[model samples]
Target: MMRRFLAILLAAAVLLPSCLRHRPGDSGEATQQKDTVLPLGFLTDAYQVDSSRVRDGETFSGLMNRLGMGARDAYTLVQRCDSIFDVRRMRAGNDVEAYYSADSSGRRLEYVVYHNDRIRSTVFQCRDSICGWVYSRPVQKVRKIADVTIHNSLWNDMIDAGASPLLIVDLADVYAWTVNFFGLQEGDRFRVVYNQTESDGEVIRIDGIDFALYNSGSFSASAIRFDQGDGGNKYWNEKGESMRKAFLKAPLQFTRISSRFTYHRKHPITGKVRPHTAVDYAAPTGTPVHSIGDGTVTLCGWDGSGGGNRIRIRHMNGYETCYMHLSKYASGIRQGSRVAQGQVIGYVGSTGHSTGPHLDFRVWKDGTPIDPLKMISPPSEPLRSENLDSLGKLYQAYLDTLSAR
Candidate 1:
């Protein structure tokens, strides 16, 4: 299961670009023509542009000197831009663009732009005195739809169908409460309608997913994004039920069960027949382990005998969960810490009484050990009736699209 999950993730990353090629309205034609001219920040057509990535050990002063600015001028420019845009804080591998005056003999610097991220940038302008200001780049959001069939796994199948790898994560999150990803079988499929954000013709991120439909063997599920007029948006089902459950289906993303809770089983290390009270999830060392539900950390330390670095979370209604064999705890994860569902609390490790790196996950109900796999958590409140009609129409429209495909 671990290998299959990883394969799905890896395939998504490898196949996203190809899958996107089939998206509607994504023609290969360039949006900007060769004759079309554009300004570089505050600089006009009279400047020559040079773009490069910040190199290791490169300093602002050194960059300015190489760009034909005198040492005194570089120092003065750095001083003026210190508060607005600290040149010292420039990071390696980020894009930097320098605009120089068109004159061949006296090629003076006009402006310098540093791209902080997809939407934010900092510009340093030179005139009588140098000054800097932060600005935003315009982003475009495009709506797209896809119908994907699961062959091996959802991640791999989506990639094969030319959808974004990030979309896989988002879709999984939407159905986290309703679906058991580990239980997904062959022939399962899903359809999704989502928006993709782009800047300068490059995909920046997935803006949001509007709707989704998942069909697993005999079971089918749907999720629709709706606004409740309370300044928050949530995913709800076709029947106006909230998709969020009290507890997540699993503690970690993309994992498989290595061992199950059983009685009279032979131990791997000791070779002694005993009752195993927990389920073990085999994963790579350092894989993030998340809290199964919202709770308070009651115990956050080592268990000397084979438990290794462990954490016990106490939940509402006499429920408790334990995560063992963690290599290290997440920051702010200590005794008495409050953790939300899906929050990373530790990482997979083989610290004590373990043959390999895996998570020994356990749960207790009313102080009695139970099968974590069989624990069924209740869903959150259903959508209010006042907004049901509008959401129902939206959900039907998405469902129609899925059926058409």
Candidate 2:
């Protein structure tokens, strides 16, 4: 019985091996199953990305520069948008903003400029090459402006009007040549465009004038600086006419107009009316008197107390001017001495007449005394002809930009 069982087991093992061998070969081809293609869905279609918006007082170029724009891009933008801005003209308080895509490449830009509630300019830039907006800002919420009149000097009025001293200095520079602070008065007014930025806290100042309207008892003059191309900024009239008349009204800062030029003028000391041929300027002793125009001194002498000391000049225009009642003559100033307009020739004193210190001023034409106030002096030349075109263009451009803003 044991032998028969063993024989059966051996036969079964042999049969099992033959069956396994015939079943399959162990090749690696079973790993080749096909991969199913799944379609991709964009996340943008389901979700929007958050972005930042710019506010008023934000600069466009500054923000654009902070981005990755190269020099070429900036140059192109300025060139294409020259009518709006040159990239460098952006002010710190302008309204501007930028909209950037999630990836930060595509962008939309909007900008606006305002002077109080008055709109100066508006613009927009976008990936599609055009941009603009209805620039809205609550301007009426705050701000108060007033025209503060300044006379005799700019410093005090500017301070009283709550102007920055820095602005006062700037305003003085504009009217430096024409507005003599020494001769200012209590009636001069200044128009200043300023914002009450924070009530008593701070203010933003802009466009200030030293002599908006100067009423010097003898004459009324106002000066405004204007660009004339290569001639740069020169003072002119409100109608663009040059304020630089033939000559300034007075050579010295005289407080009062003394004796007028008259054929039969009386001598104050003599108590006898003589032919007073000049105007007297009453000022402190030793005050300097200037030559009225470019000329050579023809006389410098004393004539007792009635005339005191006097100096006469000969101008190329055949015109003559006389200065009298001088305390002393300027060094190097004598007969035949060449002098320019506003050059000091002498000082104020009670030398000639019985009155206090004063300057007796006179003008002559064809050797005849005339009203100095009525004399029309020639103006300094304007910009050279070569620069007129450039000046005109710059003026127009400035006006356009100024108007836009």
Candidate 3:
């Protein structure tokens, strides 16, 4: 009887193997099989990959020919990329890859991949007939929060709080119209929520700021990002007032007030006690000078009356702004040219009479010289009444988040 039971067990085990054999479409064993594709969508196991960086002055054709491809084949490959990409757009320090056959044929180059940027790449298939196509790698958007108190400079304080340069630039852009970055006090604080784009676990850039709160000892303001379906996104305050004003607080960044507007002031270089109607901002040479508001250029040339390279713009409401002591005028800035707010118009320099590198900025209201620092700029279009309710809730939530942090 024991022998009979052993024989039955052996027979059952042999039949079970046949019954469990994987069918053609069965999910049991086939589910484990996955295609090992590289980031460029090529089979990873099928090729031996070699990575390189595009050297300065390296052309696409030159790079392909250097990798053992014939000149004729390289030319053909370039022609195929006419609509796909511009070969001239390839830049130095960009990543590249050459895929060779793993088995034989002297490791023939079968494909080449060029990474255009952090997320975009172009793949060129070199088998028999060359073909090219552009591919974009999947990017992940990550939300980040930053809260910082200024003990030193804004740049240093934000960097110490693990904020990227790009992120800080975005934050500054949001407050350009309202805050004077040059006048930030030591105890000024900032809190913000923003998004960063990532590929391969590396942060590429700060996408945009969702909300921000800036507080000085005397004043406080909050910026909430809101879209009104007007094809552009804008930031607003809790009362639904637009944060973007008609003019930026200052023309350039990273500067200090060296001189203020006064009627009876002693000139430093000329030793003349005269009316200095303009505000002089001390900055290094070649610092970019931006237009404070949207206006048309009325004058862009060297001034013989002590102000060297000068640019005068006439804005709306009988307002005019002038920038003097510029080393050079920005391209496309000429007489009768229209410039937008924050557009770079010139560079700081010691071009005028008796001064180092500094910007002489002046503002006029109805042909009367006024203090640029004390000039009150009007805000942009406010939020529509229908959108105010939602914006209020969003602002409250963002304010709560900032306070909690």
Candidate 4:
């Protein structure tokens, strides 16, 4: 009986290996194996995922609570991750995700992910211990070249060419001192080489412009971005001359000339003719008014009933600029305060002797009012002699790229 039992056990062990082997047409339990891959680097296939956008007046704690996270764990996460990432900075309209795992009591929150922007996110891990970490998606920088021709306006032409709207701001900044954007005519052309930043195949923003060429009528100009190795970067021409000037071409961007400077003109509000020395720029109320050049605030107050809210800045070489009919003054814009060129001093409004919202911009030379439109500003410093050659070579290379097609 012992020898018969041993023989049966040996035969059963040999057959068990063949029985466990899965075949192509087998309908056994082996086909039900679970996938082990994790999504978003945190949750596994077994967990359920839900996404939501942050609503108005909703806090991070409130969001976590709604996702089944306990109050104690939420508080612990907020407290511990304060230094690494501020939970309170989560903004409305941004996306958030919750991951849940099933237990004896049902599904429970395990992790929460907050999307900061296109390239950044924050994860709150709450499985075994309450902790959080901030992570960024990989970004790809692509070099692009564009050639645009104008038929109506620079803004419209650039937009029609499949370029980002942010590119217009960068182009304005590069040629602010030289080109007259408001006066761009038909047949004007622009060629540029720039960097576009993308994440997950979607464009986030235009990183910057490397080189640009603008031709309008017989006038032609080029701007090249060069780093000076001192944590400073500036735009320059092919001749190594800085593109910046002592004064900007306009105090505000994308505005029209409502009224030009004249010796005698009919007031829009009043019927009587008067000397309207300042140029009136018609813009919506709250349009920012910028300083034309670096200067100190000579005066910042309500100029009686005619001038409304006003700020006057005194610059070098007996130059002074005045911005009138402001809705309010910018923060810290007090008398004797130093301000830089393009700094916001006030906002446009229809206050004190105006028919509608507009900025009465005026400039003075030696206390005498001058036409703000006709005044020519000198350029800023040029590149050093030692750095000019290197910048010239780089500028030529960029120009070659622009001319490639």
Stretches of candidate 2 off by over 4 Å are 1-222, 227-233, 238-241, 262-266, 384-405
Backbone clashes (count) for model 3 = 0
Model 1 lDDT per residue over 1-405, tens place: 776665444433422110111111123423322222322234245468898887889898887676667788778877866766677688889898887775547766777777877677777665454666666545678888878887887778887988877787788799888887776778888888999987666778997889998888778998999989776448999998888888887898888888988987899989999999898999999999999899999999989978999999999888899999999999999999999999999999999899999999999999999988788888788888889999989987887886686
> Which 10 consecutive residues of model 3 have the lowest summed lDDT?
16-25
Q: Local error of candidate 4 at 198, Å?
A: 1.0
- Candidate 4 lDDT over 1-405, as tens digits, reads 776665444433322110122121234523442121222344245568898999999988898889888888889878877866786688999998887877798987877778888766777776565777665655679987777899877777887877766688889999888876766778999888899998657778898998899998888999989878665548989898889989988898988888988989987777789888988889999999999899999999989959999999999999999999999999999999999988988899988988899999999999999998888888778888899899989987887776567
Q: Please, what is the TM-score per model?
A: 0.73, 0.47, 0.74, 0.78
Best by TM-score: 4
- Model 3 clash pairs? none
Candidate achieving the largest lDDT: 3
Estimate, for each residue in 1-405, the C-alpha lDDT of model 2 and write its tens digit: 776565444433322110111111134322221121101101122223233334446555545555434445555555665653445555555443233334366542222222212333333333333322222221222333334566444666667776665555444444435565444568776543323333124433444442244454566554545556555446654445565554556666525666666778656657676687666678999887887678888988986656778888898767888887788999999998998766888888877554688877888898877887567666666655565565456445534543463
The stretch of ten residues in a row with the least summed lDDT in candidate 4 is: 16-25
Q: Runs in model 4 with CA error above 4 Å?
A: 1-39, 42-58, 66-70, 79-84, 97-111, 125-135, 230-233
> What are the Cα lDDT values of the candidates?
0.79, 0.54, 0.83, 0.80
